[model samples]
Target: MNERDILIVGGGIFGAAVAYELARHGLGERVLVLERLQPAAGATSRAAALLTMVRDDPGQIALARQTFRTMAELEQELGEDIGRRTVGALHAAPASHLAVLQARAEVAAAHGIASTWLDKAEALARAPWLAPESFDHAVFFPDECYVEPYLFATALLRAAIARGVRCEASEVKRVVVDTGRVWGVELADGRRRAASVIVNAAGAWANRLSVDLGLPLPMAPVRSQYWISEPAPIFPRDGAIVLLPAIRAYARPEVGALLFGIRERQPAVADARTLPADLAGFVFDPDDADGWANLAEGADELAPCFPALNTLGIAHYLTGPSNYTPDRQLVVGAAPMIAGLYVASGCNGSGISFAGGVGRLIGELIRGAAPFVDPQPSAPGRRGAFDPYAPDFLAACAAARAGKTSG
Candidate 1:
């Protein structure tokens, strides 16, 4: 049996971020990261990489601001281009979310997060890709940007490894619990590894891991799909990530092409045991081609304000799943039923934006240190026993089935 001070499962953004934090704190020698597949193969790889500083909540916005600051420094320190492009972001306000947007901008400004209300003409001047009459107002977060998610994941892991963090390609099928504490992990190869503390950064499989430990979790998966427009030299070169308020879509340029996607209005779930065999190197089928076609139409509908994005080509498309909580917050903190186990999953769709700060906070909590931010209400054990047939679970399952079409 191999022994480690801390064992982290799942090598996606969550695990990679935690490993980086442990290394940054000079604890890398005691850390172990076990991945069933290559790193960034899960939701991390498909993240839109939007760095929005103005969150719907005050605390989360602050946390995001801190994390973005840290990411900027890390990119510089590593001398790697993790694509931390601070091109800014625009939140179009439909009648439904106008007040919410106004309130959020105020909260962000009070905290020194660069945000302002932009009139239609000024906003359109900056991002000539939106429809002129699409939004009554735009809340611009100048500090919010985007990052190349795969690069961010790999760069963080590289830095951690350079600091002596150990990583292995092994599937952790079971968690060993004893006396109400996490004792170790059991791998599919029948190898048992012991750890003083266990961190379940296991993305979509988090709830299943909780059940295996006799501590059912309230988190489930939500499916969000995206598509990349074909290469076009005429697309807008410099503009904030544009959002269409009424249509629930956002579009940005990627490698001389445009990427667009729709946010799922509802949540979804699927059996964790049936995860795709290959996390990386997956492709989209022709039968599902129409699924992302409408995203472009939505983008075109908002084209008057963003003239540069009025017409574009289709480059490629992909699908990713996000872990959702009952309150639509994140699931963080120690497992109430398991004393030595902690989880930092269920970021909904904002995991990439929240990864850096979340890992640091969760790492501190696991080591009994004071957390940087007050943990939200979506704690892993906030909901009692899990029921697969419950209303929430059923909704998640249905969405998951509908989301199966992917790249």
Candidate 2:
């Protein structure tokens, strides 16, 4: 029997970030991470990796801002470039939705996140790619940035490994709970491991693990689609991520091309216990080039401001599961009904943006330190059921709440 102080299931951004934070807080040698597949080979690798404070929910905005600071600190301490692009992001709102964006900007500014309103001409001036007629108004988030999700995940994993945290390629079949407290985990091979604490950061498989433990969880998996443009110079060389409120699409300048992806609401399930898992139905791998060619068609519709991307080249296309919640906010903190059990999943598609903050909060919870972000919206009990919300998560919590009921 392998004994450990803490056991972490899953090695995605959430798990890696938590492990890194735990090691930094002095639990490195005593923590064990279990990953059935290679690191970052799960939903974490498919993250859109955009970071912005333009959210309607106060809790999410706070968490995103705090995560931004965490990324800054990690960059300074590790001296490793996480591929952080500091170009500010522009959020364009359709004429009918201008009020919503304006109100969101005010909420963001109140949280110490600076934002400025840009007229259509100003937005076009900054992004000459726009087709010259895309929006009624825009909000410029000067501090918004983007990081390569996979690279960041690897950085956190490396940091954790350096601190003596051990990780193994093994699947966790079940969580062991006795007398309303978590004992540890049970593997598929009839092996049982004991730990003082169990952190379920399993991403899309979170709900299944909780169910195996006989605990209720309000998390589910929602498939999202994204496509990479073939190397092209038509995209902006240097600019912030461009998001259009009217269209559920975004484009960001990467190493040699533009990366575009959007969230779609679809219920999906797959074998959670499998290694090197295949996400067939849950992932929308379009068949023909035109399948993904039309992905950004909304750009021409809503973001006519950036005309450069209207005719970009077709690049490789991929899709993956993005764990979500009824409120679209993450499910963090200790399980209300299961003692000694904690969760850091249900991050939707924004796991990369919130990974740092999630790790810090989990570290605080484990070490009995004061948390910097409030853990209410992300609480497991925030919703009574697993309901799909919006792709723009922050603004969807209220609607998610309206559909909640006591479990």
Find the candidate with the highest lDDT and give its number: 1
Model 2 alpha-carbon drift over 4 Å, by segment? 1-3, 119-121, 262-276, 280-310, 382-407
User: Local distance difference test, per candidate?
Assistant: 0.72, 0.71
Cα lDDT tens digits, model 1, 193-266, are 98878899998777667785667766566555677766665446666777665555677667767676764444
TM-score of 1: 0.88
Q: How many backbone clashes does candidate 2 have?
A: 7
Q: Highest TM-score: which candidate? A: 1
The superposed Cα distance between candidate 1 and the true structure at residue 78, in angstroms, equals 1.1
Model 2 Cα displacement at 139 (Å)? 2.0
TM-score, every prediction:
0.88, 0.86
